[model samples]
Target: LVIDEIKGRDLRETLIAFGEHLMGAYMSPALIGVYRTVVAEANRYPTLGRTFYENGPARATGRLAEVLEAAEARGEIDADDCFRAASHFVGMIRDNLHLQVVLGLRPPPDADEARIAVLSAVDVFLNGVASHR
Candidate 1:
């Protein structure tokens, strides 16, 4: 389901889908709690960090990087640094909405808000990449 959410008919659609999915997942209470607790205890229990990386963001970011690399090969974007671009892409999605929720500065976005936010993030990222390329 998670992988499918990040797969689309095209790169643009995939970015949108991924952004939407990421926002929704990150905003979930269970996920947020896990992230908080993991970070807080990761130093004392180093394997917790390893587990989180393997099971969580690593999977998504690695997938995203692979997609970006394919897109670059296809001349779809100017991604000289596919991994960095992928990381930045996810950061763009998470920075505002996810951070707000984590900080308790704002509630999680509703479906409509999530849709709009994801759309905007995809557009901004695509535009930036287009120009950079």
Candidate 2:
């Protein structure tokens, strides 16, 4: 669903959409609970961690990498490694806000906060990767 929305969009648009999806997922209490549970039980069932990584973060990173590869091909960005770039972008999107939420240090960001965070991340990421030409 999210991947379909990001596909064919320009780099900035794709990143914004992906960031929105990350914010939505991170803000969900149910999803957070599941993540906590997964972490807590992962040591006992190592496959649980691998399964979560493959199904969640790995899938998201792969989809983002495809979009990034397209952007590089079109000269919208200058990434020699789309997968690595995608991982960095995803990290920026997650940021410390996700950590705060996961640790119960703070509630999930409000919509306005999330928007600001996403936009900021997009700007910084583009500054680093945007095509000079």
lDDT of each: 0.83, 0.87
* lDDT per residue as tens, model 1, 23-55: 878999999889888988999999999999888
Lowest lDDT sum, 10 consecutive residues, model 2, at 1-10
Query: Which residue segments of model 2 deviate by more than 4 Å?
Result: 129-133
Per-residue lDDT of model 2, residues 6-78, tens digit only: 6777788879988888778877999889899999999999999999989988888998898888888888988
Best by lDDT: 2
TM-score of each: 0.86, 0.91
The TM-score obtained by model 1 is 0.86
